[model samples]
Target: MSAAGPILEVEAIQAFYGTIQALKGVTLQVNQGEIVTLIGANGAGKSTTLRTINGLMHPKAGKIRFEGQDITTTPPHQIVAMGISQSPEGRKLFPRMSVTENLEMGAFQRKDKENFKDDTERVFEYFPRLYERRTQKAGTMSGGEQQMCAIGRALMARPKLLMLDEPSMGLAPVFIEKIFEIVVQINKDGTPVLLVEQNALMALDVANRGYVLETGRVALEGPAAELKVNDRVRKTYLGEG
Candidate 1:
């Protein structure tokens, strides 16, 4: 790990959407080279926490840091420039844009061509399907293919940390498995990930550590293996009694 500390740190954050409170003092961390997952039921504030961290929604309270630098009040665009890139819940790609164009947009804040080329190559390496469809409009692709393009676009940012929200949503079982496998490979290749997913089984499988959220609070947290076997977690999130 860098002497700078965790790749991301969230301390007791509270968030609100209009009058509705979303995140209630949630705290978490993603250390260098680790995949940390946030798993919870619907309305448990999983996505809210990610939104708060990414600056799409600012926390009403608490602090956020990236690489030990305070970013609690950073603007969303600046936050992206600061090396935190997020592939949001909906694969919000530019529908009219080709796969390569979408990936290029990911590097909009970047000015270096050589590194951009390298990053695009790395993304294609991870998702060869993107390479095959490089010229196809993103909106015309299958859900799985679009998901890969979304992630590939995020990778083009060459983020110091990647935050993926619900990557497996709407995907077929086969695609889900493939996406999770690639997630592990990406983590292994050196980008720390903070994943917010409802697929607790798959999320925990790839995660190094996890936090379970309930009603906007952290209900449980531990190493992934421990959380996997926890009675409550198994019953609530893992579909077992």
Candidate 2:
């Protein structure tokens, strides 16, 4: 947790889906207690970057380090155990499972089962709606509720770094605002977050720093407040001229 060092680092990583390269020497870092966001258009390799860090897809080149340890080739489960968890895009919930059950699945790798209840309760504190439907099937819930469950499930893993991929996708404006508020609250509670969001304005509003990705490379990066006013960023991403 040194002030000069990052908690997670991605160094010039290159990734591919089959033969098509999706990430081109992408590099970024998340310092301890910071919300660092990656904002980009569709197919800009934002999701690929998260998948690479979480070990769902290993990069053919470059490196990933978490807490100064190499996890470039670690398995997904091992990555989770190492304290990096991702609430993936698409809110991939266990459709038939109860909301509570889906949350428990996040803690499946925990060695200490005794604190499970406390962890679940903590998620309820963040999203009270989750507690109200704890016994309901995941698929029966609304999109925003399902997104809450997805984030709650990731938190159940008690990660040191939480990577959220498009948490605001498919939600109404009210729910979207609430989700971003919770994300900021989570960061305040001490978990560093690497958020990939299409809502550029909202993402920049909540993030401490941000990187703009395009095609497969980083186009711009700086403190979020600065980027929000940068002429290029405002015209391209923020829909301003």
Candidate 3:
């Protein structure tokens, strides 16, 4: 699962919406089959970075590469075919759709329909509560259940690289623990993760590497364990001396 080259690379990307700039010359990389995190405060442009990579947001300048192929200009749906999938900041489920229906949307680009069905069952294995509520409308579920559905939906795509934005946001402490544990399990099962999170402590614990973001750019980056013990990280993020 080792990436001979970076599975995803952002080279000096300057992303914007008209005159309003969100990311200023940001750059980072995610190695194959590894969990790499981007940690920052709100409005630090972390979510924008993930959106650009997934093609939800376009880059006004710079390059993005996946599996050594340039994908900076690829459309969102096509990007999915190339094996990158995102579970965005908001769970974004179809409120009127049943949990099963919402999951089916994730595999829309897939050619092997039968395998996609099997994959859905696998998603249930990981989040068994989803199976119990499969026929229920998505909007009726709790925050933690919705988060599980979002992640499970992304897995339906069988992506090579998964991008997750704030998977633990708004959950209770116990649910947050369950969510992080599921993230580690997903990574162990062979899909690389590019995680953008507010929960720096848990993110660093599960990740192989981490990048600290300030404003719209990478401020610091290193092995997760090293970052965890850094004085700056402790004082600012870990809330310690």
Candidate 4:
């Protein structure tokens, strides 16, 4: 792929949960090394959008292309192998597993031993808290620590496109700031990010570009700074004037 080509592309995608539509003709793109955000109210299908792209949820219609190949119907495992990884909403870490074990689980699809070791160190570098508590059970960790573990697990996959679904969901104000800062650092280090967040203001502030999801469709999109100043977005999503 060219340096300017989109790293991930979704075109006219419609996703569903057993007949109830969650994504209605949603389309978006993320370019190489950029941070992109999807922001909206609850039940606006932001999580579903991320899940569909990672193949956790299949779209009922349309296409998803990664690195220029069509992966619309690819299985979730295959999608992960193809370099897309998601830290899902709610920080779904395994309760009984040690943090290191959880991170190991994330690289299950890989057979390369050296790559796994390198990625594990990289994840710990990104979240030192995880490294310090590597031997502790994930379920015993605080919400913020668990979120860090979830992100660390995803990072263990060494993805080209990293998708985060509400990383700030239950974090304190301070942890929220820290998480977003780490996101920027990760993107700057060459992994493109697609963030799905209800914290619209924070998301937009960090993203290079953004798309506003409303009831499963995109109602607005543009550069992150531009959307931050958009009046309708301010009033409805950003909790601004």
Candidate 5:
């Protein structure tokens, strides 16, 4: 983790899905260059938390501060401009578009278009497969390849904080390992990440700190190392006795 202060702070935020609440007073923080993960089971509101932070869902109450500014109700595009980018749960790539085109969309908001090639090269360096399939349609690619493109797209944004939702979901074990390795490399290259994942063991392995959410509320919070060895965490999330 970098010495810089918290880049994002979610304070007791409550979010609802048309009156059926999804996030119950959730609070968490991601400091500069730190890999902070939110781990939970299905329907645990982990995705909701990320959506709220990204301004896709407005909080019913509480505040979200990014880089020390209040943005609880900011528009999603505006939030993206503020250096927060999300590679959402489904990868959400443009199925008909070529890999290069999909990457171009990620940098659509940048005024510095001249450096787009350089940025794309950097992403290719992270996932050589993307380079190999630069002209292929995104939807036609294998799952692992698509996943790499999704992450590569997010990197094109050059965000200060990257929020990933279930990045390792549905990939083979080898691809899962590869995805995590890229995550580590991304962090080492100076971008902080707020990861949401169902794979608790893998998330904890790469995260500097983690929060466990159960049924729309935070159930446990601690350093990643501590959580990995925690009796309750080990027994419940890790499937360890």
Candidate 6:
């Protein structure tokens, strides 16, 4: 890993929807080769922060830097091509498209096709179910399978940084465990990940560091192990109270 600074940085970002401010000067970073997680309750601005960084929602204030370049105002597609790809919260796959076709759309913006076949094979390796259902329509797959395809599609972009939002949502417990394992393996393969998850226990278990958000502000931030043991976090998020 490069000893350089963080690959993705959000410096006091403030985002708004209409007149409602969702992010209150939120600042975070994902360094190379690390899995950093953002854990929070509903309406804590986790997804909004991602939307802002991915250029789906430009912040009214603050700067976003990816690999040391300013991308606060960059377009979403440009941001993806610049190596920041997201598998959003809802598993937003092309329902009518086959698993292979949906994966193809993920690489639609890539200028390099030399590794297309190799990358597809890698995705299949990660989600063997996708391989079995490669020709099936994404919408017709089970929730877990669709989630796998959504993540697989994001991987097809060959992102330098992968951002996943609520990846474990609406899935069976078995699939959740499997998903987190794959997430760790993905990080091991050299792509830094920014995870926004509702499962605080699972998120902190696999994360190197974590941030806790409340009402759009960072309530606490620390090493994942530390956060996992924090009194407040235990009571509220971990169900340890």
* C-alpha lDDT (0 to 100) for residue 235 of candidate 5: 92
Per-model lDDT: 0.91, 0.95, 0.91, 0.91, 0.94, 0.95
Model 4, span 1-241: residue lDDT tens: 1237798999999998987999999999999978999999999999889888888788989999999999998999999999999998898899899999999999888878688888889988999999999999999999999999999899888899999999999789999998999999998899999999989999998999999999999999999999999999999987776
- Model 1 stretches astray by more than 4 angstroms: 1-4
- lDDT of predicted model 2: 0.95
Model 1: per-residue lDDT, tens digit, 70-183? 999899999998899999898999999999999999999986767987888899999999999999999999999999999998888888999999999999999999999999
Which stretches in model 5 have alpha-carbon errors above 4 Å?
none
| Residue 204 local lDDT, model 5 | 99
Off by over 4 Å in 6: 1-4
Q: Where does the lowest 10-residue lDDT sum fall in candidate 3?
A: 1-10
Candidate 2, which segments miss by more than 4 Å at Cα?
1-4
Give lDDT tens digits, candidate 5, residues 178-235: 9999999999999999999989999999999999999899999989999999999999
lDDT of 4: 0.91
Model 2 clash pairs are none
Error of 6 at 82 (Å): 0.4
Error of 5 at 23 (Å): 1.0
Query: How do all the candidates rank in terms of TM-score, highest first?
Result: 5, 6, 2, 1, 3, 4
lDDT of 2 by residue, 1-241 (tens): 2234699999999999999999999999999989999999999999999999999999999999999999999999999998998898999999999999999999999998999999999999999999999999999999999999999999999999999999999999999999999999999898999999999999999999999999889999999999999999889889997
lDDT of model 2 at position 172 = 97
Question: Number of backbone collisions per candidate, in order?
Answer: 0, 0, 0, 0, 0, 0
The all-Cα superposition gives candidate 2 an RMSD in Å to the true structure of: 1.3
* Model 1 residue 29 CA deviation in Å: 0.7
Better of 4 and 6 by lDDT: 6
Cα lDDT for residue 134, model 3?
A: 99
* TM-score of each model, paired residue for residue: 0.97, 0.98, 0.96, 0.96, 0.98, 0.98
